[model samples]
Target: MSDSLLQLSAIDIATGSNPLYTVLWMHGLGADGNDFVPVVQTLDLPATPIRFLFPHAPLQPVTINGGHTMRAWYDIQHTDFIKQEDKAGLYRSQRAIVALIEHENQRGIPSSHIILAGFSQGAAMALHVGLRHPDKLAGIMVLSGYLPLVHEIRQEAHVANQLTPIFMAHGSYDPVVPVKLARSSLQLLRDYHYSVDWHEYPMAHAVCDQELIDISRWLKNILKEALISDHQNR
Candidate 1:
């Protein structure tokens, strides 16, 4: 609802050209839109032009960080994340993210051609918003993040994306977001019959090369249609 949409950096096709698809990515706590810019380059994507939008979270005081102000999707009230949730902040960011999705719709990219992705706190946001999004999406990618609002996701999650593919990856040795948290989230999605392509790497909270390879492969599978369409036009 605010000007959060303006706080984004996009890697787009050439001027005056419209991309057939878009990937709206979000950054983790304390990071800005530039955090994942380099990751895009490493992805072995389809030939079809794809736009990537990295939106920055609004600067706010994070309680877990001793009230230090930083760019975070929501305020962490406690170390035990799900015990006491930030419902207000979560919904606030959700509206902002929904606005971003609508902005893409106005630019001629339908929800079906867009992928929602994020890492850490950003990943949590992506999962929260993407599930409740009214329209079907290409897919949801979660990197080192867990599902929030689990108690209400069943009631809140839209039916449109129930069948949407989900790609989730996490590190086994992750201290920040414990691997068990990610696993439980995966189990919850499976319990609800959501199609999830899950992966685990032997690393820390950071991403590994193998994980990137897996992510690239998953993206190719999701966007293969665009690749085929682009080839026909060429």
Candidate 2:
């Protein structure tokens, strides 16, 4: 699957005539890319031109959900996410996401000017793929999700994103992905010395108004820094 081209469908949003920065945002399990479209409109972003890509995950059977087919990045074999790992599905989706990043590169946006982000299962993908991506990225943003395939990350993580900033937020009352799991992931990243900015909301399994504000601020800051770095390198 890694060698094959991915034909995943997506919705594109360009904030200006020519976008200088790109964000690849993935949706949660069972949901399409359109899940987070409305949230983008609520963010108070900077004046910098940006392009946002929301890609739909491929349809697959989820074992934990009674083998029901849905749009999931990987299959969940059990409620204990760490127990039964889906290596094949995770790596396949990682390659598909890498294809999207490469697509952005072909369209004139460098990896340094791109941000990979997601929510829930999508968030897990963002952490999994961004860490292993061979090129430097602007940043990674994760919301209401835990890290998957944690055991393999240390060996497989690329050096390009070793210092990339990470923004993680979670709902305090999230039942789907317990806040404890999110905290453990944060701790793991920190233990590995990754730069992580963490936040907790008073909601459950979803984003809130304050979380959107924080996301906007983080995005603007990273983009601003990326623009500066790009100019300096040129």
Candidate 3:
């Protein structure tokens, strides 16, 4: 529960022995680390050698919600369906993410063995920071996510994540972050020569069962890849 760097509280979960993988999950606006706890357990990933790090977002004034103070990674411009944007908040959040990455590295988790993921606003930050950082992480999972900094990212994305596998899922009927946004973002990433795995669900602004299943399978695949790479290195 330290405010060092990102003001994040981190926990490590080990299954058998040494940690096999580290999955860092960030929650949506107004949500806390507990938001994804259900998904973590529902997936029954406790048996896997994965270290789940769910970081809490710092409380902030959300423009989209009448400036209510909530656990937000950043701020939105407004609640108007058309004027909602969060670039300023995202910039701050990315700095926190970079600091969080350094902290994770200090904890003995190699970037090659880490997975960056998020939901909603958190997902937007995930896409921003996960792709631009100088190091290559194992993977990036964006669930029910929208790309907030597409223009800046188009100008700023580094070559490192061009090959880093990204698994993103969104819901078609989502009124919050429209599915069109996600699809267009996927196209943008592809246009940028990024390796991305994209999928669409039938729900609205949320994680559905099928998406969860897809995420679980995708996680297992990346974990397998991590193990293969680790073994090859040894």
Candidate 4:
């Protein structure tokens, strides 16, 4: 990992040895990389080792939280996300994430073998950056968050990931990031004919056991497909 690109330290976990694919997961606002560390063991994945990279978001003052400094990808100006988005912050984080992807590429893992996963604010960043990423990715997993920069995504989305599989899981009783926002993002993706696997659980702004099971299945399916593609290309 590049210290300049990723200012904060990250927690690295591998299911086993000889990892073939990487999942770069980001945490929700105010949380560090360790936020989702425990989930690694909970998901029932295949026997093959999978690398999970959880990077800590940079510390910055969040407007919605009374301008108190916290670890967030970007600042949330108000409750209405469509208005007054923190574009500068979002783009800054986007570049940093791209650099992280490049770092993974240098480690013998191609862009197509990488997955972007995140929660809440981090999920927003994943949807924002993964779609606009220059190269194709294995998949994107969004948990309990809405897509940021809704007006700009349509114009800025890259053609490389036009058909990339997206797994969006939201909570029906989410108080932080409303389920309605997630559904609206889903509707937009569907409108553009994007392949999105949407799931909703009757819970709050948090991950559930059933969601973890579903995520494990999704990871296995996508990673298996990526491995096949890798073999065919070689």
Q: For each candidate, how many residue pairs have backbone atoms clashing (under 3 Å)? A: 0, 0, 1, 0
For model 4, what is the alpha-carbon lDDT of residue 224?
Answer: 88
lDDT of 1 by residue, 1-234 (tens): 245533433444321256878888888999888888888879877677788888878888899999999988889988778878998888888888888888899989889889999999999999999999999898899999999999999999999999988999999999999999999999999999999999999998888999999999999888985456457868
Best by lDDT: 2
lDDT per residue (tens digit) for residues 1-234 in model 3: 123435666454445566657788889889888788667766645365677778888877777688788998877775432255666667777887778787778878888888899999888878888888888899999988866666678678877777889999988898888887788888888888888899987889888888888888888888878779889999
C-alpha positional error of residue 44 in candidate 3 after TM-score superposition, expressed in Å: 4.2
The TM-score that candidate 3 achieves is: 0.90
Minimum summed lDDT over a 10-residue window in model 3 is located at 1-10
Can you give the TM-score per candidate against the true fold?
Answer: 0.91, 0.97, 0.90, 0.95
Tens-digit lDDT track of model 4 for 1-234: 223644546788988887878999999999999999999988888888788999999988899999999898988998987679999888889888888888889988889999999999999989999999989999999999888888888899999999899999999999899898899999999998899999999999999999999999999899889988889999
Predictions in order: lDDT:
0.87, 0.92, 0.79, 0.90
Per-residue lDDT, model 3, residue 88, is: 61
Question: What are the clashing pairs of model 2?
Answer: none
- Model 1 is weakest, by summed lDDT over 10 consecutive residues, at 7-16
lDDT of 1 at 160: 96
How would you order the candidates by TM-score, starting with the best?
Answer: 2, 4, 1, 3
